[model samples]
Target: MQLLQKFKLGKSKKSPSKGHANYAYTTARVRAMKSKILPKETYPRLMNMSIDEITRFIGESEYKEDIDELARIHDGVDLIEHALNRNLAVTFTKLLSISEGDVNFLVGEKLKKYDIWNIKTLLRGKYCNASTEEILEAIVAAGRLSYSFLSSLAAKGTYEEVISELANTEYYPILKGYDGTNLSDIENQLDKMYYAGLFGTIRESKSKDRKLFAEFIRMGIDLKNLVTLFRLKKSGIADPEMMNLMIDGGLRLKHRDIEKMMPLSFADFVSELESNPYWDVMADVVRPDMVSLIDIETRLKKHRLKSAASFSHVYPISIVPIMDYMLSKQNEISNLRIIVRGKAANLDDDIIKEQLVI
Candidate 1:
């Protein structure tokens, strides 16, 4: 709590209490946080180093404090992973606190998605028969939901109890029907409800950031749909079942688009996607140096990051910049983990770089 209060989530007195957003100071704090993002040049240098060298390199960077605290207990990639997740959670929790008024509304609404994630994580852990400690480690702790709340959720002995605990949230309605079904189906319900809740908020929003956030949500939906479609296609699932699995509200890949691509082979769908606005996002599938589901998903995530950065540059004072920084912080944690783990495994530099979202 002391650490959380110390940072104050980039808040300053300049933040508005009502009416308008406090773009000035809100962005000021966000910019400072964004500065800590790994430079493009760093990846090139780190790729050549061994795992020990990579750990040493991270110790000298912004991760130094986290690395220092955990170094005595864990080493190598595990140390890096724990430190990074801790840092990521702290950063995001700060963002949720500092926001106010319109900025608060936007950030808060977006952060609710993390609660959905926690529910999913708990359900998954219970379904897999994973121990409570194992489930606890997998949590990100970045959401508006408190650490205690999530911890309690993780300790639940059954999926029904987990869902019952979440009954007060929007997720309960969707999950209630699937109490006895497979966890995968329940997880799929959570995903659909989350996107649906997002679009519902979008409908009620009157802020300038509405269009920006709407697009961000759409990009997420499209990527999610693509990933789902590909997996279902590979499984030989029928169109109706695949459609049920996909969440709507995607920007480029609409109902018509999905309908058109459903009957075609995966190659044909990739070719069809190449000509649309989603080409850059799906480009990894059409032009990957290392063809893989992982590569394709990484590219899609990178596209969203680049788009957020570009949007923030053009609209610096808006909510876009804050969201951009928050996302960049999360991606930094992930990218560092990728590099650390990849280096620890002694994988080739190119292979590691291919998996990076930056």
Candidate 2:
């Protein structure tokens, strides 16, 4: 209790100014953490393992503590899923704790997605009358909001109470718009808010590494916009108003350029994308006749992770390496989940491999 109180007191406060970031220490710690990520060869090995074998495999790795802690209540795939989320939460929270000043602030900003994710989870869970335990299991408390607070929100008797509980947070205004319906709208709005906030933070920083980080973010926005464009085109929605789904501030693809492509047929859209810089990332998987956007999305994600890994070495004692480690760690967790869940679902090994970034 005392330690928790101390953490809330010291870690809760945002750094007052730019201040000195403990980048050397933070990046060193991040380097050691990155070394623990599952090797590329591990995924192929995991694919051939049965669920039990897979569970044992992770249980013996860095996830051992999480697996042991959650073993009593959850078993099989459920146990692995919960342990993965818990480990992710603990790992990211450790980053926040170990970092100071600007590093802490930037890390927190990047992680706000978890907080947003928790809020959305709580609301969605309440909307569908899911039990608190079920809602809590879906949560990854790797953000600014503490799990205790999110858990309390999850336990709220009604959505109104949940919204009221979050009335003091930055998301309150948007939360107030949730009228038991429009969950998707609210979710989109919250997502937009997150990217806007992150972009705004980056724009305010003039540091060289931060500028590079901003480029990384812009690249993500471009990919997200491309995904949205593909989905809209696949759904046959040629309406220009769909542009509202497009985010601003992309590194290469501009808002005007996306607007121009909104009315094009899927074939034309693919043709148009060929001239764009991102085309190279997914050209092998992209085609107008493709039935699924899955391949394109996977390729794009892999490219982004690979790009971050490449950049991590360029600037060692800056936010770049830390960000790279975070992305790599996230990819590791995602890949493991894909293999374990895929095996449990009896998905074909080839199909599972298609989804894996490694």
Best by TM-score: 2
Could you give candidate 2's per-residue lDDT for residues 221-334 as a string of tens digits? 988898899899998899988888899999999999999999999999999988999988888888889998889888888888989888888777788888888888889899
Q: Which stretches of candidate 1 lie over 4 Å from their true place?
A: 1-20, 178-180, 230-238, 280-295
lDDT of each: 0.76, 0.88
Residues 236-285, candidate 1, lDDT per residue (tens digit)?
Answer: 56566556766778887797788777887666666676777777656546
Q: What's the TM-score of each model vs. the native?
A: 0.84, 0.93
Q: Model 2 lDDT vs. the true structure?
A: 0.88
Please report the candidate that would top lDDT against the real structure: 2
Residue clash pairs of candidate 1: none
